[model samples]
Target: MRYKGFVIFTLFLFNIITIKPKAIDEKDSLYIDNCKRDLLVLMMAYSDEIRDIEVSEDNYIYLVLNNNKKIIYDDKKEKNKNAKILDADIQDTLEDIYPLDSINSVLEGMDPGRGRSYTFLNSIYGGNQNEIEKNLDFFSTYCGNIMFNKKAKAGEALKNALNEAKELADKDNRVNNYIFPISGSYNYRVIQDTGRLSPHAYGIAIDLNRNDSDYWKWVDKSKGSKRIEEYPKELVKVFENNGFIWGGKWEHFDILHFEYRPEIILKSKFFGDTSKSNNKKWYEGAPLNDEIENIINIINSKL
Candidate 1:
């Protein structure tokens, strides 16, 4: 009996010692599992334009375009040096990151859309003012003639979303109050106080209902009123569902702004579709996820 017990223990110990953690496969090595869905969708959906994507030994992500333009993403916000996703900050499931049901829902400074990969954007959209300018097209909405990136699919996305909102307004006139009389889009310039170009420069952002909009910079710092709940949640939701990120969610909130950033909506929905119990950090892969691919499929079909 003692010998049998000893053999059983030995076998258990041997099994434990021999077991290995799953190796990070080539796919996972090139693209962290968390980011693979978003990246793959981007590549396959734009396969004609995008050639390949690779990861460096140090884990920097590179997007190689058909035009041979290479864009690298190396921003590591969380996990200190251990961040696994390029631009992991914004590429996260944002609604999960800042739960709208929470007491103070506006997680200021935690702007998930602010992690802009300038090189990646310029490569995908146009590189310079001259290149960007030629692609611009003006679409007339009830709001006004909004100029935007027609070739990049941004103009059409905005137009479709606004048209849907207009349809909703026809049913309930209140929706019209949120969108119009107009604010500007397609401004060819850099952002004030920064060298970076605004999404407006790419003609991919719009300002709406400027009178009701609250800008953080315009506010006196001593007033402590940066967190106003003015932008209609319904209007915000409509824009967000259509691939736009609201500036009202930023610490440096600009209540009137909405910029087209489909990836954010994709990542947010990916998280929203997964297990709620696994509230791990963004880098950690979700345990059981099959929907992001389907979501991407639907998005691809639309595109």
Candidate 2:
């Protein structure tokens, strides 16, 4: 009986020593997992433009574009929110997770998808004003002539979103007030009080009918919060479902603004919910097929 007991204990101890912990935090921890997640999301989001990823000797990751241009994933710099908005890395831009569910109140100190990565933008979209203008095609909406980028289907997405919104307006008269009289789109202008080019400058953002209480700068938090709640949820939903992020959800709320940011939306859709504790793979919830599986393999092996 003592011999048997000793063998059993030895086996148990060996098993405990040999069994590996799950790769829950593979590289660094949640940070590495998040980096991989963001990279994969970007891959799935812009599959047409992003060709492959490059890992450097010093351990820098880059998104290799079809045009042979490479954009760094993270500079490993420490920057405040304002600094990030001005000059942001892909990491910094995607750090703030945008909530998909409707919000009656404003987000505090976080504007997911608000910070513009000019390096990434200029790579996918046009670089200079002239180059960007060349990619522009005037899109006709109830908001009048709004110019949108032809590259990356920015124009098509905007058209589809507005067309759906128009159908919604047809059924619900209340939606019309918010859909019509769009403020502007495709203006090659810097944001007021800042040198950063507006998302509108990229022809990816559309501003709906103006309200004095629509913007954070224009009104206090009380009024902005009221405007958000008062705004038609369906209208916002329509835009979001069509690959847009609502400015009303931002800390620096621009209630009338909706920008086409598929990467942000993809992350929200695929990795938003934390209830999937049963997931064996990190990329479990995302739609899987040939290309995505291939990307997943590459990410797992590389990252």
Query: Which candidate number maximizes TM-score?
Result: 2
Candidate maximizing lDDT: 2
Residue-level lDDT for 114 in candidate 2: 81
lDDT for predicted candidate 1 compared with the true structure: 0.62
Which sections of candidate 2 miss by over 4 Å? Answer: 1-27, 142-145, 274-279
| Worst-scoring 10-residue span by lDDT in model 1 | 95-104
Cα lDDT listed for each candidate: 0.62, 0.85
Please give the lDDT score for candidate 2: 0.85
lDDT of 2 at 295: 92
Ten-residue stretch with the least lDDT total in model 2? 19-28
Error of 1 at 18 (Å): 13
Please write out the lDDT profile of model 2 over residues 227-259, one tens digit for every residue: 888898988888888788999988999999999
Question: Each prediction's TM-score against the native?
Answer: 0.69, 0.87
Can you write out model 1's per-residue Cα lDDT over 1-303, one digit (the tens) per residue? 999999999999877666532233533433343555556445533445566666677766666788888765434456431232233332433222422221223453465565465666677778899988888888877666778887547888888778877877788776676677557788888887767688888888998766533676776422223334444566777787787878777655666788887756655554544434344443234233464444344433422
